[model samples]
Target: MATPLWLAGCVAAPKPSVQATLPPAPPPTLAPVEVEPAAPATQPASLFTLITQGPVSAMLSYSEKVRSLNGNELNAELARLGEPGDVPTAQMQTALALAQTRVPADLARAVGLLQRVAANTSAEARPLHPLARMLAARYLEQRRIEDDRDRQVAQLRDAQRRIDQLNDRIEALRAIERSFARPANGAAAAPASNGAKPAP
Candidate 1:
């Protein structure tokens, strides 16, 4: 059967086109990273351990040894210091020991040694300088205190002597007063006896 021209034209027209669909793309991969291991925790060093292990260790050790020595050993140590060796450590040890003795002569010697050590500006003596200066200062203060105490003791002795003298003077004055009183009483009795009696 024959159709209309418009309907024939519509049939001859191409059917509606359908578009193809594609799957979604995958995410990009990242590079791997390296991580470092953590370090272990550590405690801080103590002051005692630090002082005992460093350049000044020998001096400190020798000082401690001197401190621990008995009377005989201590005297031996002091006698040893008088020998030919002028070692800094030995000097420090001797000074420390002498300081402990608390004798005026020994303290004076210790102060001299400490001052010598403190005065040395050499690199070898640097470690001992601080300790030496500190010890010297302490000994100086002790000497000053001792001098003040001695002066005070002398003043007290003088004051006591003066007080004793004053007491003696007071006793002498009291004796003199007693003597005068006795003589006055006797004189009064003599006057009374010499005077005429009153009529009854």
Candidate 2:
């Protein structure tokens, strides 16, 4: 135990700590821009040439791209066409005919646009721009077809209404006739005054 003190003195002593100080960083500087001298103003584009030309086409075409969405594709469809279709493409195309009439269809607008184009274009240009003329013609034909369908429907409704009115009139007349047939005071028809037993 007495020899341990000498052994401890031979061990190395701990080192002192050292502190270093540095200056704060300066603010960042921006680079200067080199702008060129002023130049003459540019002329505006001529829109007269465009306006003199025919009206633009308004045909809205559907896409073949599949909307691969889950839970709903409706939000996507509205973004494309301002509304959604009642049926998906598969059922829509496969249907023999639609049960309900298509509404807010832009076909009339397209037809009108095409017609204006055709009317304004030169006679020689008609051949070159045959698509526009054809579009107007197609829309006119469709309008005629719709007109015919509406006329048929109106005729059918009118016939049905007429039949109903006729039935009402017949019932009223039948009631009047029955009223006349009933005798006064619940009495039956009186026997012949002469008691005409003589007649065979």
Candidate 3:
């Protein structure tokens, strides 16, 4: 069978290639990220801040007040503290005030109070324990120093007294020697006037 020339000519034309080569995809571009600067790391609270703001701050403040008090005021404070009371804070404050007096009896009382505080095992009193123990140790050391000083003072006084006694004894011996050197008459032995020997 003979096909139509025009249709055959159209079919004979080579089919255009279906696969067209495409330009390689441009390298993927990353948009610049606007990252917010990380917030500066927060610094830890300092010891001074902790001390000033922590549970012990009240005691520290009260102690400062106690330290600033005059003798008469401190005495009055002691008198007030002597009244019957069982509050730990009050007890601590009283102990602090007593410690400042430097009187043996008062210091003894303060040490006792501090010891009580340090010995407390309850959770409520735990915060005070360290401070109390530290204060008690310091006061005990101070007491030892004071006792040493008193002992030394007593020793010095005794030494001085013994020296005085020895001095008195030496003076007595000198007096006896002088008495023996004198003639039988109560008159003192006098030196001859011109280096001339006295008549035998």
Candidate 4:
């Protein structure tokens, strides 16, 4: 039997579609940006070290007082120590010496004590606390400069005295020469040793 045109189209197989199902796309990868690190900050000079020392029994009492004492209290403590001229214990020396610097009147004495402490301290041992040898060195340098200046002033004074003496001697010699050149006491002029008369 012959089929109709519409029926033949319906029976024909459908053509395959060009579009295809695809898997989901993954996230894009990004390159990481590099940054330079900042430089470390510089520390200012200070007498105290940041390192904490283990508690020393000898320094325990004084160290506590130094940390908490006011100006008046510090003065009193120093006065008490001054009565017998008691030497400070080694453990408390640095802290006590540093505390002394706070008193204007005690500045020189404090620096001297620090110098002695620095001298006695062994560098290989634990570092000095609350006091640096640099402070002692600076004080000594100032003293040396002052001494040198005093010597220079003395030398300059001596030089000035010698110059004045030489000037006075020169003046005296000039006066003597002038007097010798002039006829004295209205004396008559000396006759010429030669008998020959001077020609006009």
Per-prediction RMSD in angstroms?
A: 13.6, 18.9, 11.9, 16.5
What lDDT is obtained when candidate 1 is compared to the true structure?
A: 0.75
Candidate 3: tens digits of C-alpha lDDT, residues 86-152 = 5555667788999888799889989998888777776656888888889899999999999999999
Please give the range of 10 consecutive residues that has the lowest summed lDDT in model 1.
Answer: 38-47
Query: Per-residue lDDT for 154 in model 1?
Result: 100
- For model 1, residues 1-200, the per-residue Cα lDDT tens digits are 35787678777667799988988888888778769433322322222433447546656666677777887788887786674245565567678888767689989999988777777776756788888888889899999999899999999999999999999999999999998899878966985788967568
Weakest 10 consecutive residues of candidate 2 by summed lDDT: 91-100
Query: Which window of 10 residues has the lowest lDDT sum in candidate 3?
Result: 40-49
- Give me the overall lDDT of model 2: 0.46
Give each model a TM-score. 0.61, 0.40, 0.63, 0.38
Clashing residue pairs in all predictions, respectively, total 0, 0, 0, 0
* lDDT, each prediction: 0.75, 0.46, 0.77, 0.54
Model 3 gets an lDDT of: 0.77
For model 3, the superposed segments whose C-alpha errors exceed 4 Å read 1-55, 184-200
Candidate topping lDDT: 3
Please give the ranking of all candidate structures by lDDT, highest first, separated by commas: 3, 1, 4, 2
